[model samples]
Target chain A: MTEPKVKDNDVVVPGEELASGMGYLPGQGTYRDGDKIRANRLGLVHIDGRAIKLVPLAGRYLPKSGDVIIGKVRDVTYSGWIIDTNSAYRAMLSLKDATNAYIRKGADLTKFYSFGDYVVVKIFNVTSQNLIDLSMKGPGLRKLEQGRVITVDPSKVPRIIGKEGSMVSMIKTQTNCRITVGQNGVIWISGEPKNEIMAEGVIRKIEREAHVPGLTDKIKKELEKTNKGEQ
Target chain B: MTYSKRLDGRGFEDIREMEAKVGVVKNADGSAMFRMGKTIAYAAVYGPKDLYPKFLQDPERGILRVNYNMMPFSGMGDRVRPGPSRRSREIGMVSKNALLPVINLTDFKNAVVDVFIELPQTDAGTRCAGICAASLALADAGITMRDLVASVSIGKIGDKLVVDLTYDEEAIKDMDVADIPVAVIPSTGEISLLQMDGIISKEEITEAIEMAKRACVKINKVQVDALKKKFEVKKNE
Candidate 1:
């Protein structure tokens, strides 16, 4: 059998040949071109069994169904609210899925969610043309209030959240802040003035060093150091 | 008068001293700066965001829009106009076509990806430099691309053939000078962009393209290095 040209976690650019054998299946950011696997984007190589894929390092947030996101209400239409999910496509949060309350149509829809308000929403449906359908009727999905909102690289969201929320939970316990990380990279933090600022700094640090080795250990140490300073 | 030696005291196929850097603009989705000889080009990639004109939006794939601008004082000659001109407009369109073959924008439907190339200093080969920089920025932005496009100017100076032309060589009054800006996909040897000014023999055109393809192979190495260096920084440092 022919060997793979690239190993796991190798930095690869577009058009670089990964492997030229039929034994490999092409995954995201990679394609099979006449029995040769080639990368179609700049990312790290990930070999999963018979499939080879790439983990992107940068790009705009791509909206996906069943993803919780933080969005800003750009326009309040007659039937629903138009939300900007920090993506190329806008999401429509209809009145029926917006809230459990039953209200009459054409009677001040902005009363529920007005313009420029930030809300936590869950995308329920996405069309082939990229039309997004949002629903606010989920656990912990509501309009954010009095919290500072910031954005990070969506590609690093999984790292910031850590493996099964371990990384974020550690930060929350140490900083005593409530942090909501959106799959789209929008984050909301609310807590005491001093702790909230600390939480934001930690999150930004994670974003910067997401690709660094021993990232979890480094973040844990940094959080403890800040906690000692506060004592 | 016969021309035997190059005006810059360099070999015919030699490209000038070059340097490239990526992620120069902090706020842009992806950005880069490329400098060759006296010419310098900066390119920034933005969007895949909402397309402004509703009619221009395509349901199948995103569109690429390139804006090429030469700063007013970039050239040694008279000041260039700040806004878009006929020359810049034509270059922008050609540059867009130059990059379209390599970039895959199918993931972003009904959106637009904008690449802005600004040159603060230039001697010659300005559009070619801009194309090289834009290709690097697009790849750095993590746009799905089949390959990176590298560009250089192949000049036919009098009876001599040159890989990259300097301003002095183009301005030589006594002999015929032909400037050909060509962009190539290094992996495939496909010429995505070709533009010519002045005159050259039919047989010499093939030779010029081959020379450019070689120079572009060397230039592609620099582009690849600039991107890798961004992520290579150690976290402890």
Candidate 2:
């Protein structure tokens, strides 16, 4: 077995050799050339047993099925609504998957979700041709009310949400704000003016320091400080 | 008329004082500024976003567009017009071709990636520097690429072959030589872009290509270093 040349968290550039031998399968962000596995992007390298992959540091969001995303209604067609999911590929929200209500033909679709309204939707399907289909019938998926939206690095979404929902829940409890984080890097916060600002600050900090070790602890400390200030 | 041999008092094989910085344009998705001797160039990348004009959208792969431009006062002579002249258009086309193969366009199907290269100071090798900066910018954007493209120009002066020609060296109308600018993907040893001017024999072309390849290896190292520095972790103060 050939050992991987780079360990986890080690930064790698495109075309850098990861491993050269049999038994080492090329994974995401890596390509195979003969017996050598080489990186095809700039990012941190991860070696899992016999598989090697790279997680890119920065990139636009690529829509995937089952991902909960925040989308803006760009246009409303007769059959569906064209949604911008903060990705290169736009998503379609058919009237069937959009809501459970029955609607007559030529009825005003804009009455349901007007142009520029943000909707929390889940990607139901992403075709090989990059066509995206979204669903609004899922739980916690609906139109966003009055709130401020901020964008972050899409790759940092996992960090912002934390392991499970601990970090986001902690922020919500401390700031008394309702927050919804989209997997596409858009965060919606709604609460009292003061609490909303506080939540925004905490979320921005997470986005900025997402790559740092022990980030959860750091965020916890910061939240504690803010809580004390409120009292 | 022997005049200081060449500008900057460097040997034929020596490149100019080169430096690069990534993320120079904060608002851009990715950006890089590169300097080769006195020539300065900046490149910014936007998208993999939606392609407008519905007609131009390709169902198979993303389209890569490069716009190469120069500031009105960048040249040594009178101010150049601030628009897409014939020269800029040609350079943009070649630059786009140079970068097309390295990027994984299929990853962002039905999208477009725009690269804008702007030269604020003109010299002999602006296009080469632009390619270098654009490559860095693309990598900074985290676009999946097979390899970084490194570019340099080799010019034959009198009886010697020189790397990275200066403005004065390029303007010599009486010299019997060739000025060859080449961009290469060093890892794969693939020539992505190549342009030549003046007269040269086949043997010289081969020799020049080999020399450019060696120089590209060095340039690729610099590009990697700059990227590493940009993403380097800093300890808490």
| Top-TM-score structure, candidate number | 1
lDDT of 2 by residue, B42-161 (tens): 999998799999899888888999999999999998798999999999999999999988899888878899999999998879999999999999988889998889999999876677
- Candidate 2 chain A minimal-lDDT segment of 10 residues: A204-213
Cα displacement (angstroms), candidate 2, residue B24, comes to 1.2
Write one digit per residue (lDDT tens) for candidate 1, span A8-40: 988888888899989888999998777899989
Q: What TM-score does chain B alone reach in each candidate, compared with the true chain B? A: 0.97, 0.95
- Stretches of candidate 2 above 4 Å error? B1-5, B234-237
Q: Per-residue lDDT of B4-81 in model 1, one digit per residue for the tens?
A: 899788888899988999999889998999998999999999978999779999989999999999999998979987
User: Per-residue lDDT for A1-231 in model 2, tens only?
Assistant: 767788888878888888899889999999997788888988888888788999888888989999999999999999989999898888999999998898999999999999999999999899987899999997999999997888888888888888899889888888888999998988899999988988988888887776687888888898898789778
Candidate number achieving the greatest DockQ relative to the actual structure:
1
Model 1 TM-score is: 0.97
Worst 10 residues of 1 chain B by lDDT: B228-237
Q: Any residue pairs clashing in model 1, and if so which?
A: none
* lDDT winner: 1
